[model samples]
Target: MTVIVRDFRPEDADAVSRVRRAALPFEVTTPRSVLFHVESANPAGKYRLLIAEMDGEIVGTAQVGVAYESGTPGQSYANPQVHPGRRGQGAGGLLLRTAEEHLAAEGAVEVYAWVLDEPEFRAFAERRGYRPTRSAHFQRLDLAGGTLPELPARLPPGVELRTAADYTADPRPMFQADAEVTSDEPSDIGAELDDYEDWLAHTWNNPLLDLGLSTVVLVDGEVAAFTAAHTDGERRYWSGMTGTLRAHRGHGLAKLAKTDSLRRARAAGCTDAFTSNDAENGPMLAINKWFGYEVCATEVRHVRTFG
Candidate 1:
């Protein structure tokens, strides 16, 4: 079968979403969310969404872009997803090749991707000259019936809990906290959230993010910790990013924020909760475990260089 890889069209929203959902059932994906990503992406990121079609039928999709906000330059990312029913075809490779060429042309020095932990997926990445780096697991919580931890009776002194909506007038403080914690996150490609405008265009404007369910822990007026939440407008809730500032790491602020967020999410009709954690992040992993989340799937970070 001839697989043709090309730029995504506005009409490809449903097809792109279908492929993503079929390839990775654990994550929530919607047509509007996909369109929002493409339209709202920062131009500095040089973001491109591509699709692979076989006989005029979409079979695979990839999201490619530079880490424009990274403190460091030349870092890029490309994540490809092939439809489950269409897997043995050449769509995956074609989509990946197109993504790499696009990124390389855009001055990317290294391309990072996530490969499923399964042997076949790992071998495919290795065959493509990609080296494994860190791994992260997708965790799931049965919010419908399973028991959740009771909210703590009291928080530490100088600590108060709030939601992302509370920062509506100004989110720079939350952005600052995110920048600090993200810089310390374990990964092969380093990121720097130095561009406030880009962050606002992308992160802050993302459609799936539910600021009301996102919990923030404020320490004496400073954003100490937070758990950003995202939902698919249905039953699933996602912990988009959860982090604690360096100075406030030991005070259980991360837990406090996440706990508050999860409680609110459940109360708002979210049935299932999901989050991803780097396998080597013992502290965060322990925190998620304390909340009764279990690993449902794992993916390894893979990197490949051009030239």
Candidate 2:
């Protein structure tokens, strides 16, 4: 059997989602989300969803794109995921090579990817000149059976909980809040959210985002913090982001938003909840632990620079 890498076709969405879910079960992905990502990617990103096909079957998928939001120019990423059952078949190498070529053609001088922290995965990246920079953990919570902390009887003075749906008429406040909080996230690449229209196309209107389950904390009618939620519309749910504005950092508003969102998810019949955080994010890690989440897997962000 021979494996070849090629651009993703419109009909490959389901197979791509299956490969991603099989490779990273802790993450939420759907056919519609895959297609939306490909269709909505900004041209500046030079994004390409590549598929590794063996015969007529798609055994691996990779997302290649320049990180246009990063503080540095020409920084790019090519994250490839091969089905666990299909590894050691040369598909990974082909996918990586194809992605690198495409990114180089697009004028990327530095490339980055996430590799599972396990021995073989790390070895594969290291052999190809990728160096480990930062690590993150994928945490999971049992929403169907495990115990969850009871909601506080009283919120802080003048604070209220609201859902993203409440802002259907106007989502500018929530977008602003997201922009502020995201700019402060820990990363090798510092992103500054400057385009509201881009955010609307790529985030607010994404197919995986669950507006009803996403919760926000309001301080005197102003957006203070929020926990964005995404679901597969059945059993699995994921926390897209949980952040608190600088002014409201000490009031536990982030936790409040997340807890409210999780409760809503459980009530909606989602059996499993998942989230990920950078290794150095002590506060968010502690909050997840407090919510009874356990580390299910770990991944290291690998960087490869072209000289």
Candidate achieving the largest lDDT: 2
In order of appearance, the predictions have TM-scores of: 0.96, 0.99
For residues 111-203, could you state the per-residue lDDT of candidate 1 as single tens digits? Answer: 999999999899989989999998999999988887887777877788888899988899898889888988898877767888887778778
Clash pairs, candidate 1, are 70-192, 71-192
Which residue runs does candidate 2 get wrong by more than 4 Å? none
lDDT of 2: 0.94
Candidate 1: C-alpha RMSD after superposition: 1.3
Write model 2 residue lDDT over 119-189, tens digit each, in one string: 99999999999999999999999999988877899887899999999998898998999999899888987
The TM-score of predicted model 2 comes to 0.99
Global Cα lDDT for candidate 1: 0.89
CA error at residue 139 for candidate 2, angstroms:
0.2
